[model samples]
Target: MSVAELRPNMDFWQERVDMAAAFRWTERLNMHEGVANHFSLAVNDDGTQFLMNPNQMHFRRIKASDLLFLDANNPKTLEGPDAPDPTAWGLHGSIHRRCPHARCVMHVHSTHATVLAALADSTLPPIDQNTATFYNRYVVDNQFGGLAFEEEGERCASMMSDPKVKTMIMGNHGVLVIGSSVADTFNRLYYFERAAETYIRALQTGQPLRVLSDEIAEKTAQELEDYPEQDVRHLNELKAILDEEGSNYAS
Candidate 1:
């Protein structure tokens, strides 16, 4: 059968496709960390139920049908045949269960973001438009209490309690971002990495930095947030490119 013919007509099919495309594109951007990181999307009204990538799967190879549907409240989730990675279950489950507003969660150990996270100040200054986009919008988790098991996950989720904070600079760890959808979250993740790269490269130059004023930074952030359909268009164009290349992500 053709890939389209075998596609499942289940709930959240489009969400799965979008998420798979995000995964593929993330890999293409060299943002994925081997088979370690994860992405999840809430599938239920309360966000307790969600979909996640299968355990240890590489982003480039993940198809829409390969996602695992999970319930954060279910204790037996980790014991199933298609069980997710423990850290994924712990981190994503905590977010989905505690933060209903965070409909989608993406975690990565991308190079620049992780470097920023490792810094003593883990702060992204408003150096330029890209960096300014995240001004005062991210929370820095200074406490790195090992891997994201249940307790660690709970602590991380606690920091995201503020409705306005959509990104977390996981201190000594990686980065985590949440949004209303896959496109929005992935877009944030992509830009955050780009912003981090810019900041890091600037720091390496040893030259005096030209930082934006707080007022202008906030204004830029707000303007970028309100930009029309950029996130949707970004993901659509990526999916179109994948389709043209005969990628199986949507399958």
Candidate 2:
């Protein structure tokens, strides 16, 4: 559809479509494990309520309008046919309630992230540009006292307060990334998983891993200020690949 011809509500529908697309894309990329992963996006401008995948649907089966609209302030989820998973409630609900700046939150337990999380030292070494994308903008939450619940989620909110840190390594759990949009979150999540995989594999090689100096790593990360436009191109390319394979993603 032509940009000029798009409706005023296009952004709303597009957000839903893209949110659904992120879930399906994660599954296709092997980034989801059953119904474990949770992805959320704040709705409207004030960022009170958010969009999240329904309680039990596998990532592949998610549809645009099928998402649940949840209120962050209300402790009890609105009476609905599709309640969100309890863990999702614990993780995303706390974020939405506590982190107003976190408009979009993504949590996943993909192979690489889980692998890195399992490490005694789950810190990502600045090995390359991709690994350097986070630089000081990532946190290692070493204290994983079971799933995020009650005080635990509140603990997460405190630990995840830095605006610069787009991603967090929930030690012994998985990865969490926040963005202004699903495209941004997914892009960061994708690169983070790949970067972690690269970091771990390089360590396995047993060669002295070349680590970038903090100054250079910070510089490289600053260069990623261009990533908003860069990420649009990247996400479009990935979307095209998925479209070629199947168009069921946003339906």
- In terms of TM-score, the best-performing candidate is 1
Model 2 TM-score, 2 decimals: 0.91
Candidate 1: misplaced stretches above 4 Å?
Answer: 1-8
In model 2, pairs of residues that clash are 137-165
TM per candidate? 0.97, 0.91
Model 1, 48-117: lDDT tens per residue? Answer: 9999999999998999989999999999999989999999999999999999999999999999999999
Quantify all predictions' global Cα lDDT against the true fold. 0.94, 0.83
Clashes of each: 0, 1
Q: After superposition, how far is residue 209 of candidate 1 from its true place, in Å?
A: 0.9
